[model samples]
Target: MAGSRTRRSSRTRTTSLTDHLKLPDGYGRPPEQAGPQGLDLARRLRALTGVDEDLLAWVWYERSKYTALGGVVLGTSVIAAFSMWNFVNEAIGEASVLALLPAVVWLLFVLNLDRWLIAPQPNAKRRPGPLLMRLAVALLLGTVIAEPLVLRIFQTAVEERIQEDRHGDVDRLRGNLLRCNPDPSQPDHGTPAGCGSYLLSFGATPGGQSTELDALRKDAAALQKRVDQDSHALEALDTEVREECRQLIRNASSGLLQRTSECLRLRDKAAEYRSTHHTAENERRLVRMNDRIGQDGSRLTRSRGTFLTARNAEITQRVAQERAKQKGIGVLERMQALEALTADHTALFVGVWMVRLLFVLIDVLPVLVKFMSHENSYDRLLSARSNSAVKVHSAAVHAMERESMADLEIKQEVTDQYVRRRKAESVAAHREHVAAMNIRERQTVDSLEEELRRPSTV
Candidate 1:
């Protein structure tokens, strides 16, 4: 029994010895050798790089499954914000609404846009590497598309508002001018439209001064009155003369005494001719004189007809020329009138736009305040959130510990036996003192030498 107990005690001691020799599950048999300060150094490097769990989480989130949803939410938010601005602006004025578009767009780009849309993959091959690069490219493209839209909306809204005010002002001015009758002597029909806004506003008061337009207007009125009077007198004189000529011809042809005298003279002439020794010669002479008179009368009648035809043709030609000249003049006058009106319209538009621009500037104040407050609130909320650093450290430490245990296992199994052999081989290589480039380095050197040979200078 004493032998058995002693044997059992020996067995227990043996087991305890084996247990002590065996490594813990995680610690490999030989244990890993790394710098004691490795974790501390890693932490310092991370701190220096300003890389942390929150940043990594954000990056992962951006690149992860939620990316598209985030984009949609951002886009929806932008649209909703703009809608709300419009609603509020309706209560105020349109000019303010006009200014809000670009301002909101600016804010979207300046703030939450990148956070919402851009993926932050910092460990990519290139600087600013993959995710952010894609976001930047997307942003540029978006700007190309959206900036113009914002500008157009702002411009159209502003223009419409300005035009409304200008139209109202024009109507008011026109009405006021119509009510205030100018002096009769004033040109432009004493109307505001004709006088134009500038001239009306700045012209001397009617009581104090007379302008060239006024004098010219008076002269034109007097000339028109005289022309009317002369035209009427000429019409009456023409009628009276036609009546007198008809009456004289009628009275002369009807007088009985005149017809009797003419018959007596013709008979006396016939008897005288019969009593003469050369009555045939006298008759022939009388016939010749009568033929001469007939010829003269026929020539006079033809001449009168020719004169009438020429006069009619001249009148027609003159009328046609006058009409063509008048038409050309009318066309030029109308073009001038249109140009003047266009200038007036342009001036009015410019003035109205200036006022609208001022109003827009004022309207932007509220939107600016809202944007500022939103930004501040968002920052405060983010600050209130818990830090993720502890979680990050735990994961990193777990990973490192696993890697260390694996490395120690590999070393114990294989590397430890080979390390001395590797060291001896390295010593032997060093003793040989051969300085030779590797195949890749040799090729690089050859290329560089070739380049140097060809080049005059670097």
Candidate 2:
């Protein structure tokens, strides 16, 4: 009885294990046993509940948005990556080193925020609070994780500011080299090669840190001093030019006034000439002379007036011409002087502006150089952040790939199994029908043989 009980218990365990192994076949083994009503009800059920359908549609939309957002984020990150690589390329020169941090940070922020915002989860629960709380927690976690990176970002910014200040000095020196006191003797310092400053500044060997930086500092200071000197000289020149321009303007004003007086005199003289040369009075006098030709003291008076008027007109015209000539000379002289003054003033102002720009550029060069050339703690931090984002993106992609493969495999296996089972059933049915026909044929053959064996009375 004990052995029997053991055997029965073993059977039961085996049965249980078998049941466990037989997972739901999904389809094709047998239709689920159901009452007619149950079957009808199942058939009547909507493919999707309204709310579920809407939610699913929303999810689809969200998925599309998420995909697009992810692509944008990834694209931005790729650009940042290329930018970082470019920074590495320019490592020899400080021109664009500091340019990497902001781009990296921005790319990270976008990628992280998008991922955090769209992280998938079991969304069966409708209550917004738990889901929101979960999302908030995730965001907080992401931020916490990203805190060191943020610090690095801030440090990069500060370092950039410092480097910019230093770069300004370098630029100032460069400007001085180009301008006054330029050593035409010195050969041009060829443009620095790739982003080598970082490698040079932070190499495997720890030698002469202070000495190097101090030298850099000294060079910057010298450049700054020179910039200040140039700026001051430029300012003085500007002031002097302004004063000279003002004096010139005053002189032009005096000349302009004299020209105006001459012009007025010329206008008056021309008017007098026009008045004296009256054709109407002359014509009237001629008419009287003709009418009284033989005996006319009246005709004699008119002729004398006409001769005096012609002489007055000639004298007035000569004076007007002289006055106009004087006025034209004065106007030309004033205009020429005024134009020279304006040109000189313009050139002076332009010179001052150019000098100021050079000073400003010199002052910022060091800082720009430092930020652009060297890797701060932020670069590592941002790199880590980028790696994390990449991992997440990669995991998602792998998961999707796995799911697609699994789906295809399942479909193929189901189709193959179904086809094999259908072929087996068809073969069994054909074999049974063939057997039945053979049995009938054998019985007919047996009847014919028996008849042939029997004796024939006729």
Candidate 3:
């Protein structure tokens, strides 16, 4: 009865061990049995979430939650793709199929990036160094991804700002051109201050037509001087004649109101000088010169008008050309416009940063979620299984080594035995061959001896 009791107690212990070694409730169960909703999708999306679905299968019913996380990762990739497409399009200043390649590349890169960032979990203890590094990388990627979306959100405003900048550029160009291409004759146009650096010189202007006018003015001045001198000489002569004829002064020797010889001689000489050179012809010549100057001045004014008109037309053309260059509104331009828009307004600055932070958080969600989570049922199971596998592998390797060593010893013993047997057999064979040769030699000697003993044959 005591022996039977011991046997029963051993059986009970065996049953307890079996029970303890059995799998958990979820393990070995079909995915469909996980919940009312199957885990089929959760299994597939495990690749996106960077979680092992096979390991996660035995976990608590977090399939739904992880599936949603996987969806979030996918959504982030889509957002990155869309943002990249727009970024390329905006940079080129147009939409084209060529932008699709980069968009697809970015999508894959971001998908993989999120997976890498979220997938790797510490075996037992969470190391902050690696986690922090991953978080930093995710934040950097998120920051890079946010700009394009932000630009898209403020697209209308940015476009308006770009247009304003374009117009401003055109205005500045026009002002510079006008300044640099000043009308030479019009001093009021002033110097083109600081315009040389910008290369704002416009127009192929001709020299002014003021040469003839200037020459005519010089001639007029000379003629007027001559006419004045002639008139002054005539007036002086007339005043002397009046003084002698009207008795205002008399010769000191003649005290009478008689006509003085000297006065008469002077009057005669003045009349001769006037007859030879009169002021009337000189006055007429001066008048003709004045008229010629006026005509030349009018011609020069007309030429100046033509030059100014052509110069203005060239300036307009230049301004249009400059505006054409400014028409390309690219990604950089939009970013600048957004920056300018946000610089002054406090509310807008806050709103812009908030949107950017929201996008960053969205990108960082997968990492953050996994980081905050403790080791789940799957992790524990994987750890236990991993330890078990290591022990089994080590044992197998040790067994293989022992088996190999035994095999080598057996082979070595067999080879040594074979060599010893072969050596003995060869020794025996050599001795037998030597003995046979000696017997043959003895037989010949004995035969010769018998022949010699038997006499006759030489």
Candidate 4:
């Protein structure tokens, strides 16, 4: 009676547990009341969760739950793909046909990843280690997935900020280059006293031509100085001679100027000065000096022009290089601009974070749902069904192992019996062989005794 009661209670418990898994009578029959076609799509989706569809189909809630999780994976992947599209587009500087490749690849990868994260496992509660590892992975992926979407949410402002920043950099770089490489056409005050930041070792510095030109100009000026002084001294001597020659005593009546000794002396001195200057020779010397000065002047002009031109050219090239360095927009720049936007405005900060967390939540929804949900009817049914199959398979394996063991034991008995029979046969053969040897020895001894008796006769 006790054994009967135990068996009865076990059946009762099983019936109660599996009652929900059972369909209504005739509900699963074909032609009249067929299976739920609505769950066909759900079954396909649930396949991503790596479940037994035949088993899962019986549990409607499990099918719905897993199907929803698969949708989340697909939705998260779409978001990820969109974010990737923006990244690729921004990096390439325009919409690119190639952007679709990376987006599609990333979408598939994220889809697989989220599916793996949400996939069901046996005894998940008992294994905290694997659960925690999956959680960590999901969180890391969430963060990665959230950022690009967050930036995309504020795309307009972020893009504007990025452009503004790039232009600002161009201006700043141009200024630095200009400061470092002073143009030669502009008056070079040399480098400003503390222009350390902008100054470069190589720049549009005026060359030795300026210094050489200055020296040439000074030489030209020196040449004219001696000629001017000689002209001045000769003019003074001529003036003295005229004044002495013109001095006249008032003659008694309409008297002409009389010859004066002082006048004669002045004339002689003027003649000596004229001889030293030598009108024709002095003109020749002045002409040669003027020509040399003109030549020097022309060279000075060319030197200045060349210096300005070279310096200007170098400044243009360097400024252009600097400007190029500051010109382009990129993924990193957009990210940084987003950060700046958030920092500058409280509204933006709150809004941006809200969007970020929303995307992260979306990305990790499947993981969170699987991790945090309490076990429902679906869980119990799946566990019971799977566990039952496992136990049945395990029982079959044990039965095979026992059958193998029995076969091995029977083989062992046969081998032992065969060995015992062989041992008995060998013992009998040894006894017979020993008897035969003893008889032969006795015969030898008798023959030797007879030989001795015969020898005595001889």
| Best-performing candidate as measured by lDDT | 3
Write candidate 1's Cα lDDT for 1-458 as tens digits: 44455446556765675465344443311123122434543333223222342333323332222333343334433543554454434334343746577657644553254343322222223334444555444444443333223333444444444445445655554445444434422345355454443222322233222343344445555555554555455455555444443432224666533334444455554455445534445445545655654565455455545544544454445445544443221222332433344366887446545544443333232222222232222233233332233444565566556666776787686877698789999988976655443656788999999987895753
lDDT of 3 at 253: 80
Give candidate 2's error at residue 201 in angstroms.
82
Tell me how far the alpha carbon of residue 151 in candidate 1 is from the true structure, in angstroms, after superposition: 10
Cα lDDT tens digits for candidate 3, 1-458: 44455446556765665466565655754656545544566566766976665566556476677778788889888989998999999889899999999999999999998987777453656889988998999899998899999999889988988888888988887777767777666545556568764443434432444655666788899889877887788789888888877764555787755776767877997888776776677788888889888887777787788778877777788877787788678888888888998996778788899999999998888888888888877667768767765775676566556666777787899999999999999999999999999999999999999987885765
Candidate 4 stretches with Cα past 4 Å from truth are 1-33, 36-39, 49-63, 89-101, 126-133, 150-206, 219-247, 250-256, 259-290, 303-330, 336-354, 385-408, 443-458
For model 3, give the 10-residue run with minimal summed lDDT: 199-208
Arrange candidates by lDDT, highest first: which order? 3, 4, 1, 2
Query: Residue-pair clashes per candidate, as listed?
Result: 0, 33, 0, 0
Q: Please provide, for model 2 over 66-125, each residue's C-alpha lDDT reduced to its tens digit, 9 standing for 90 to 100.
A: 334344435434543454444333332334556567557755664454444333322233
The local lDDT score (0 to 100) that residue 137 gets in candidate 3 is: 92
lDDT of 4 by residue, 336-449 (tens): 998898899999999988888888788777888888887666566667777886875676566556666777787899999999999999999999999999999999999999
lDDT, each prediction: 0.43, 0.43, 0.78, 0.72
TM-score of each: 0.19, 0.22, 0.72, 0.67
Scanning candidate 2 in windows of ten residues, the lowest lDDT window is 198-207
Candidate 2 error regions (>4 Å)? 1-352, 355-373, 399-407, 439-458
Q: Pick the candidate with the highest TM-score.
A: 3
Please give the TM-score that candidate 1 achieves against the real structure: 0.19
